[model samples]
Target: MLSLLATLWLAAAPTKDAEPPVPRPPPPECLSSQGRTVCGYQCRSTGTHADCARTPYGVCQVLTGRVHCWDPPRVVIHHPPRSSARPECKESRGNVACGYNCRLSQGEVACNSTPYGVCSTHFGRLVCWDPPESVIHQYGARTPQPRCLNASEAVACGYDCKAQRAEVQCASTPDGVCRLDNQRFTCFDPPSLLHCDHSAPPPAD
Candidate 1:
């Protein structure tokens, strides 16, 4: 009787296979960016976009209209500029003007090397804006001005035909704008400058 009772007790005990573990959503700490406080089960930024996080649960979302999330925690969602293969400016409308023509849709724009005052496409070609006209129109009439500090600055600074890396660092100055790019830096009124290199490598000294 004693041996039989012991056997029955062993049979009643739980085994690993008898109960399956429940899958928990990723931990709050697992869903945050480095050095960021975990917001509910996710990580977020109060200023600019949060740097990419290593947590497997970290996700990036974009949309047409603003959205808020309450499940897990309260969060805001917004849209990002779509990627493009060509040179074009992001318009207020969620579309891109490709090669002097624009179509209102979510996608990339095809670009060419042509300089117009507003980085506009003319006919079916891309052109880089020449100085003065490039400076006056590309920025704005009252928005201060830009000056070239070097040959590279003069030629490489402006709306990049490819949004390439050249580096035109512009800062708001009392007179206008201060800028440094294409290996040069200059100060001007309103203190802004156009700097990008279509052929240069990514941002790094």
Candidate 2:
């Protein structure tokens, strides 16, 4: 009709101002199960909600903060603080004595009824005294002191109240007790400054 109204007035004349599609900031609402998105808020996956975050272009965010650490809520434990200290009694005793009692020379091994005591000083060093004093006393290589005795016969009388020593020097088998400064005289066989012979025999092959 007049060229169709000049092609509809040049297609309604208005083709050079393009720029009206800016609506894409709506994908970050209430998410917190660690999918992230709830900062300025913008989640709309149609709203089924559960910490959403599906964005690859389809968008469905909701997380916030540290990406909003996932689905937690069930923990209540608290118990750690117990120790007042107090539990002794492992069979202790003290008041011991005698570190020597040769019996006469070394004669007393009948069947060993408990009288060969030797807590130290090296050699057979016996230790047997419990009941009405089954007797076998002579153990004092010296090394006691911890204290707390009621009398297991002062631990069979070798005197080791933990052994800090304030008195324990009672001896008398063939007679032998004095070392707290009696100078020196431990009795019996003792007298070999140096002697060795091994029966002689060995000159190489």
Q: Top model by lDDT, which number? A: 1
Instruction: Summarize candidate 2's per-residue lDDT along 34-147 as a digit string, tens digits.
Output: 453443222333233343323211212232221211210111001101222111111112212211121211322211112232322113333332211211112211112211
Lowest summed lDDT across 10 adjacent residues in model 2 is found at 72-81
Worst 10 residues of 1 by lDDT: 72-81
Assess candidate 1 and give its lDDT. Answer: 0.31
Off by over 4 Å in 1: 1-17, 30-38, 41-59, 62-205
Q: Which candidate number maximizes TM-score?
A: 1
Residue 91 displacement (Å), model 1? 12
Q: What is the lDDT of residue 167 in candidate 2?
A: 29
TM-scores, all models, native as reference: 0.19, 0.13
lDDT of each: 0.31, 0.27
The superposed Cα distance between candidate 1 and the true structure at residue 159, in angstroms, equals 50
